[model samples]
Target: MQLPIAPEGKVRFVPSIPLALQHAFAMFGSTVLVPLLLGLDPRVALMMGGIGTLIYLISTKFKVPSYLGSSFAFIAPILALKSSLGLGAALAGAVGSGIVYVILALIIQRTGSDWIHKIIPPSFVGAVIVVIGLTLAPSAISLASGGTHFSYNAFWTAMVTLGVAVVVMVWAKGRLGMVPVLVGMIGGYAFAALRGQVNWSIVAKSPWFGLPHFVHPVWNWQAMAILAPVAFVTVAEHLGHLFVAGSITERDFFKDPGLGRSLMGDGIPTILAGLVGAAPTTTYGENLGVLALTRVYSTQVIAEAAVFAILMSFIGKLGGLLQAMPSPVIGGISILLFGVIAASGFRTLVDAKVDFADRRNLVLSSVVLAVGVGNLALPIGRFPVSSLAMATGMGLILNGAFLVYDKIKPEAKDAVEAPQEAAL
Candidate 1:
């Protein structure tokens, strides 16, 4: 049998640039939303996202079809940093967070994959992921309500954004099929912009090719303290992204590309984003949903998207326009997307085939949800652990430690054997 070839003489091995542009456009709205909420530069975030994609491609030898972008997981920390240290200092903290990723990548390089799974179990991972979504509920509510110390906008914009997001997800078609998040943001913001309150001065002042206002990390103990816990939670999120990408590509990226190298891809780009006044970077799960929707598995497309983000960064007017979007508009969109994220976590537990009939699984999951959602918190002596940090930390420790202990106790001999026998 002979294999067919394209007129361009391209093979399955060839990368498609146009497809990547479509995907980037599809994902870009969500990318900038993180910076907007955290009081950072949306244009810089785009540039960093684009550059971060390039860095990840370089770090991973251009093998994986993944794009690195702003992480929602760090939203809490960025806000906290801004409150205590100021925007410049907050960005410095974001830079510090990237350094932590580099360190984790090194650890993965030195050790093996076994250590990661053994240390952070699926239960812990699920809990941490859940904590990530639930921890932001207050912020989301405040945004939906009309903004607060964190973000500013009327509650109505948030409702509209959220409603539009849900409606689009339910009824969108063809070109509209994959980018519910972007659509919701645009739809909600458009309504808010027309209200005659959106500011265009910054957009007018923004230059097309001006140099990025790069800032170095100041030594901020408080910012560092609050953000440190996020590293543990986010490692799991990154791994989950890697796993999903591997599944789509039909290759264990964790093998050849390696987790450490991939992590450095996430880390290095993040450091650069912060330097230029962007926000913390990570793998966007929404983009993963896009990959699933589009089935475009080539890294070239992701690289192109990265370039779009980079070029878009220099468009000062556009950045100003995006910056001017009302907080309620963003809040409206967040209303649905954030809930979906939490739902995805719940699905992870169900898909893992966790034996809920067993009391052990029940106990672990219950505590994970309660501690994260109920606002059960702690004071780290003189330091005040933000709800986000405390919930994330507690979820990991409670879920990880309990699951490991349960696994070893041998109490589930029958439970463990059931799945094996069924396979036979």
Candidate 2:
């Protein structure tokens, strides 16, 4: 079957512009939302996301078609650190997280990534993904309800936004189908505007052109201790995305660009994000969605999207407009997006054919869900480990324990009988 556009396919400038814009629009809402949630500059997030994608392309030798955006995984830890120690310290934690990725990449380069699979396994990784999504559920609810106290206006607006998005996702055709998130945001924003929820003065007062406000990181050991561990979870998520993309494009991204290079591509941009006071970046599922929807795997189009994002960041008014988006619209969109994220985890398990009948798999998933959803944290000295990190650690430990047990335990009688019966 002919792909709509092959990974290396060349296209003339005019048509590629819209194709690239579609990719950018697909990623825009989620990319900016992360920084907004963490009280960082959305412009910086946009800029970093663009720069990160470019860096990722270079690091992968342009063999992989992917875009990096602000990661949702680091949100809880970063927010916790920001509240306790300040933004600089939180950003320092981001730096530490990036370092973790780099270290993992280096290890994978030498020994390969088979160890990663053995340690985490598909079941454990799927559980962690579900945990990451569910852990953030309350935040979405809080945003939808208009913060600490519930408001009728906020709830209705959120519902309208979500309703529009759902409709678009299920029924929209062609290119429109690829950008449900962006479409949903616009729908929500429009509803909020009609209700006078938007504050237009922020946009009016902002300049047309300017650079994003860049903050410098302040090194903090405690902050680092809190945020760095989450990289393990993101790495697993990254691996899953690469596998999905490879399947869609009918290419072995892991073998071609290689997993080590892919991880480094993701890591370096995250390091840059930490230094420049933006959220840590990850390979975006939104980009993958566009690729699947359009069947276009063109690297040039992805690169064009990256450039478009970079250009958008410089429009000071655009940042102001994004900032002026009301809580209800954000809440409405988050409701859908976060739920989808959680559902995707279940999909992952199904795709992996994770056997829940197996005692070990059952225990691994059960414990992960309990720890992560229950928000169980373990404090070490001054630093408190997050539920997501703790859950991931526990899952790994349990899987490792199960592996050891399997090696030492006697084989099932049915297994031995089956071989003898077959011979008879």
Candidate 3:
């Protein structure tokens, strides 16, 4: 039997529940993958994700539809910070980023979004986006390689998974197209199971219901210094997401909920997630894809999905099942997922009509990509600025400098031209 399709607006409770479940499944793979990669408790991350969505709904007054999930931008920083200062320190840094969001929200409230554009132009953002994916390439490749030498079965399984995902995403019609990630995950899992790669013991051992392991944040100034700077990338990410959501729904969320409220919504939840030992949450593009495919923009449906996620968090067996997935499978998905992210960055540049021929743009973009991908670190007192933060800071400074130069050069040219006009 075919399920009744829910339209854009509110629908009956029974119809909305299935749509909500679909949204949850759409984001489940990526959401679970982050916690596993970071070695954090998958259950805690899932729980926080649902709770974060609720908080975001409240912060935005339920006017905007969004789902908060594990953010990819923080993966590199968190992994680095964790190796040095411990997971508590990493959580602290993630919390610090949340504070940065609130501060940006205040600034946006006082001054409109124009200042944001001045600080970080499309070229700069695009560069950062590109850097993000490119920097993670080594990690992705290592996982896919699987052990000291390449495993032939693992390689083919990954390829099959990626191939299935591409076909589903590019050619599938209606709601089916929206779930490419889930479909690909299932395909990968089935192939791995056939090859005896999946370990079923972990699933059998896990309990049906239990409280997720939760850890408290610890303060570390150095960690904060290293991680806080990432807020720049995340904020830019949020803005781009807002723009996409707005375009799809034909509702100007930036103007309606206003940028301030939206940032606060995302920021507060991030802080909460960090406090509870979960990776920071951000707006998920997968959910937006689902919305676009289903043409259902109802906040209530998203809310219901959040409730479902919270419920799943208590299901220990489910968490174990997610963790039991083979590394090669996850790596295969990351290959496409990260590439899509880089492509999205290019799309941002194109959509904004960023002029690459402009020297200022070229210089600013070059600096960000070079510093970011090259992993250049600059010492700042006790902390060294590197990774995404260093790239973001450099981009902003260069872009702002260019803006100032542009502002002054025209007037200086006019001053010289004024004499010629007088002579005429």
Candidate 4:
């Protein structure tokens, strides 16, 4: 087996570009999808994604290898705010969400992250990671099926893409194996073109150079209230991603960079995204999958990918070309990537040696899977705490209850010994 690359590892420029492109390909579909769904400009989302990633890298002192992308968590809230108020108000809400992250970071900086562990133990963390992967399953499937309805062409295209990816993952050797996702996408796109699915007109019509549409945020207290609470969901997800990434790289990022710094890294980019009229940014699990597959955790490679993304945003033809990628092809790639993410979570459980025989462990895992996989939403005021956030919250509450039980419960062995001594 090839040796894994460390975060600080250096690579020659020629090979590094392809490695960076692999990471860009891994992030491309979903980064743009978030903005498209929310009726925002895809170019702005791509630009913010690259910019946010760079910001995050700097904030973490380039110790953590992650690619920041448009967040899906705030899609509903942003859309709702946009409809009821205006796009400006919705952007304000996103800014407010970033403020929440910053405040949390400040608190963590002072009080430390010990409380975070107390509320979210290892067992709960594993379950929350699993929830994050499972929550994304539907989106993968929807793309595979060609949106709301299933199409035979789409299914076949997805199968071809998935098959190529699997083959590359299992059989390919050396550098080729390191980019199964990118290779699979190329193969899938080729097949899609042959089948007359590729539309070249959009790319042709797009100008070679352009700038993203930027809008300033309009602050409204009501809009802030509606969108700010959703930050809690993304915050829980942010922690889970950090844990998973740390596990993959076999480095304690939380301790090295510290959770406080990581949160600030994430929050700062999100603030920039809102200010520039783009979707909020989050650490992408797709890129994490690439890191796991390639065993390459080089921050330099990620930075290169960010640069590519920023360049892609400014080049209208390039952005349009990516936009024209068939949904089925994206779906096919997603099947493998999303599955890897979930498998990583299971690996976390195994690595931690979590004992399901313990009732506390059993309850935490079972309840989290049920709530998270089932997509149960429990509303908190105007915000509905659902999916990953709800699952994480429920797991934390359950774990906290068990901890309290352990604290308050009397020692039965001591009571029995006392009675025996009295009788003697």
Best by TM-score: 2
| Lowest-sum lDDT 10-residue window in model 3 | 1-10
What is candidate 1's lDDT per residue for 132-243, written digit by digit as tens? 6777777778777775454344766677778777887899886576777888888887878777657777667877666545555666666666677677667778888899
Off by over 4 Å in 2: 1-3, 404-424
- Candidate numbers sorted by lDDT from highest down: 2, 3, 4, 1
Q: Candidate 2, residues 1-424: lDDT per residue as tens digits? A: 3557778887789978888999999899899988888888899999999999999999888878899999988887787677778899999999999998999999999998888888877788888888888988788889889799899999999999899999999999988887787888899898889889999999998899999889999999888878877898899889999998998889998888899999999999999999998999999988898899878798888999999999999999998988898888887888888888888889889999997756567788999999999999787776677888789878878887876765776474234334433646
Q: For candidate 3, write residues 51-81 as lDDT tens digits.
A: 9998988888887888999998888888877
lDDT for predicted candidate 1 compared with the true structure: 0.72
lDDT of 3 at 369: 89
Number of residue pairs clashing in candidate 3, backbone atoms closer than 3 angstroms, sequence gap of 3 or more or interchain: 0
The alpha-carbon RMSD values of the candidates against the true structure, listed in the order shown, are 4.8, 3.5, 4.2, 5.7
> Which whole-number lDDT from 0 to 100 does residue 41 have in model 3?
86
| C-alpha local distance difference test of each model | 0.72, 0.87, 0.83, 0.80
Better of 1 and 3 by TM-score: 3
TM-score of 2: 0.93
Extract clashing residue pairs from model 2.
none
lDDT of 1 at 175: 59
Encode model 4's per-residue lDDT on 191-226: one tens digit a residue: 999999989897798889999768889988766766
Compute each candidate's TM-score over C-alphas.
0.85, 0.93, 0.91, 0.76
